[model samples]
Target chain A: MNTTLQQFNVEKIRTDFPILQQEVHGKPLVYLDNAATSQTPTVVIEALQKYYREYNSNVHRGVHRLSHIATDAYEGAREKVRRFLNASSLQEIIFTKGTTDGINLLASSIGRGLIKPGDEIVISAMEHHSNIVPWQLMCEDRGARLRVIPINDDGEIIFEAYEDLLNERTKLVSIVHTSNSLGTVNPLRQIIDLAHNKNVPVLVDGAQAVPHTAVDLRALDCDFFVFSSHKVFGPTGVGVLYGKKEWLEKLPPYQGGGDMILNVTFAGTKFNELPYKFEAGTPNIADVIGLGVALDYVQQIGYDAISSWENELIQYALKRLQEIEGLRFIGNAKHRAGAISFVLENIHPHDIGTILDREGVAVRTGHHCTQPVMQCFKVPATTRASFAFYNTKEEIDLLIKALYKVIEMFS
Target chain B: MDELRDLYQEVILDHNKNPKNYFQMDEATHSAEGHNPLCGDQVEVFLKVDNERIIDISFQGHGCAISKAASSVMTTMLKGKTITEAKKLFEKYQHLITAEMSEAVDLHEYGHLAVFAGVREFPMRVKCASLSWHTMLQALEEKKEIATTE
Candidate 1:
């Protein structure tokens, strides 16, 4: 509808996603829930199909042909993830179920190795439940205290509060990269640097970041980073945890199972080296390969193009949504990405979500798994319409129209 | 759009906009909280009973329009009804809301409650509509735990 859409060639990108082509209810589907999980592109879907159709076997176990082929593709995905994050080595990349599984892995390994009684682990108020709960459980296990860094009214983490939270007793700092509820992109380099100064290892929940922005783990200097495959246009049940080699070696194995061992006996078991030591069982093979194809898919499109298009869409959405009477934005961070959450006066988010769905506009309406952030904003929930590269400016207009309909109905 | 209107009819909308008995009952004899954790909607049902009959019923909480309206109409229906009658009406209302859409809803039978008959089409909102009734049941039973319409 405007200049940015013309340059991005979103029509071409939309065609790559088959789900976006269909209609919901009676209208064209306007999928704006990219923060939950991006729609899988045809390339990723066909890659999944080809793997099962051709080379479907367990990885690094059998010496047969199909097994070898599957192993190569699986390991090749690790290499792709390693390069995608610009990690130092393939041994530093570990595959897990998703971001939740990755955090649970770290909580277990680090809880046993590093945390002691009376120690403190710091997380921000905007963290999703996945980031918050694991640390709480781990802290309970190790007799450590969970300290929360408060965010300002705009959903930006109070940097001073974060600084005050880190001290001699602070063992680890875990924080979100881009808030799923608030759309605020936290300053990671600054956050990580501040933690490192206090000898605290920082683990970043990059679940909302990697798809919308470039992440060079080496450049950011974060000790650990995690994101989901589905959020990055890959298959579900697959995710990557990028850890530094030195840290991965020090942390204990997360689980005990097949393929994560160099040698095992009834009397004793010697855990495998760096990454596989953490990856304990039959990993998600097809989806991992799908994740590689997804990485290739994004790299081909380029993050610059994706960010610019989504930026335009978000700006347009913010401007148009403001046109509706009694509409209020929940988060107004100076730096935001891909998502915009708002509330209509005297109308619940669920009602807005229902009306929007009737118009075939899919937006997430809830606390977005960040209840603390909701408390910070002093609302029960907000209607969130997150974007992807394939979303057009016209879709934002549809959302605006649906929102106006919500106002009419409620009035 | 017709389907949306079916779900949010004028009756429901009016009840939502000007909810009845929307207050905290400090002198209530029995009260229970209902929570829909998925959407963060909550309601507290309060009752004043005299000789097994509800003399007064009111509700206070935060939730969607369906929930607020449903709660308001529920309070109006339950006032001056016996405990047994309240339970019977709850069963009938629950059956109506959870009933199959293919079989037409008997609008005359439910009266005020029929406004919520459209909720069954939207499966996710059914819980929002049902939360108050369950919380009222918890209040009647004198249960300490919060009721959840998950």
Candidate 2:
């Protein structure tokens, strides 16, 4: 409510990035690859610099003053994440290497106890390899079967198929909140409710969602949510896994090294409680503090303003992209967000990516780590232009101008 | 623009649009499928060998202009050549693309392959330019494994 149109300044937001201020290849850089990773603002960068410059020490175990500082900063970041998702308690939040690692942590730890030989795990066709492979690996290990929910041509999930997939045998339903390759914003609440009716828990991949729009885990009521910090404008190699208290308590520990233990002897080892049970080894201390600052940055801007501005940018981008001859959009979901994928009639996506790069227009080319989506669409890959709140309509015009040069050269 | 033009020359563009020997050989003595996992671009190289000589060479796949044109040009240069000669040419081509352009690469030794010299400027795309070549090598060796431009 505080972020009115007057308070929400696009130029001020653009200044926060500073990476976009420079030239890439003889022209100003137009960075539109937010889905893959958002640019870190000065606040986040300074937070990281301060951590390493001021207090560089191991956390959780050290008895020294520096270690206490590091531990508090790291734990404080976890509280920020808990608040960011609006989860019930700090015990629900677990630090992970990234989204892929978070999913792997759940799949390996949960699959051991819950997934039986004949059980089935359901996932959508639009899931990234990160969300898909871990489940496949877990299912293989447990002799469980992996089931896929089909998608419509628009890259939206078919609710009927999803409903059909849920039954007594279904153990978990994992789906992406916003597809990275296609800008499809899935109906997470509907999905969670359907799974809950059958006593099946759901895991939401919010890597593409949390950055573009607001996400409240308490409201959605999903059992688990995973996302990468880098995708949310924080440092890379950091992510969070939020699980309800019951699920976190039920699942076993993920990895073991330093920390994550109450006691260790020659005979047995007693694991720690709550979030620490899953967090093994010395965590990414500096980056974790950086993530806290990043969350603060996002919360300060207010998602209300961020959402409206990004919606306008996406609409403008879609309209401008349509003006290009032979360009066909890959996804047409009614509730899309952040990213847009399309292919030039006879040109491969990578080729378009290459030409665009020369003009200082940065867009993601290739599969975007969603090969199944690529296979379903019957295209080798698509050139995806994903946006952040820092992006402007003027930047979109630059992208369109660069795209015309692509046509001129290739035509 | 000069660098972009260097990467996508007239010959490369023509070859991409109207590739020679661009088909699946039903009776290929040897064939190999290649994948650029990063881009999901796939290519298949088929070869008909008679007495250690490549009687005919062809390629069919889905890929970007650089990859497709590279395959097309490779097929054009490979047909009717002995396996040893093909291997020698591939070795030279690999060096040509990866070598520093600042050192003044001899275009005479490269010919059509010299167009890829621009790839040195764009290091990320070097794999795209060499995917088909690696697959062709795999085909010649009769390796059943799918080749990858890792």
Displacement of residue A222 (Cα, Å) in model 2 is: 0.4
Alpha-carbon local distance difference test for all models = 0.92, 0.91
Residue A2 of model 2: what lDDT? 32
Looking at model 2, residue B71 earns an lDDT score of 94
Residues A118-226 of candidate 1 have per-residue lDDT tens digits of: 9999999999999999999999999999999998888899999899888999988999999998899999889999999988999999999988999988899999999
The TM-score that candidate 2 achieves is 0.98
The CAPRI category of model 1 is high
Clashing pairs in 2: none
Candidate 2 regions exceeding 4 Å error are A1-7
Model 2, A317-378: lDDT tens per residue?
99999988899999999999999999988888888898998888899998899888989999
Candidate 2: TM-score of chain A is: 0.98
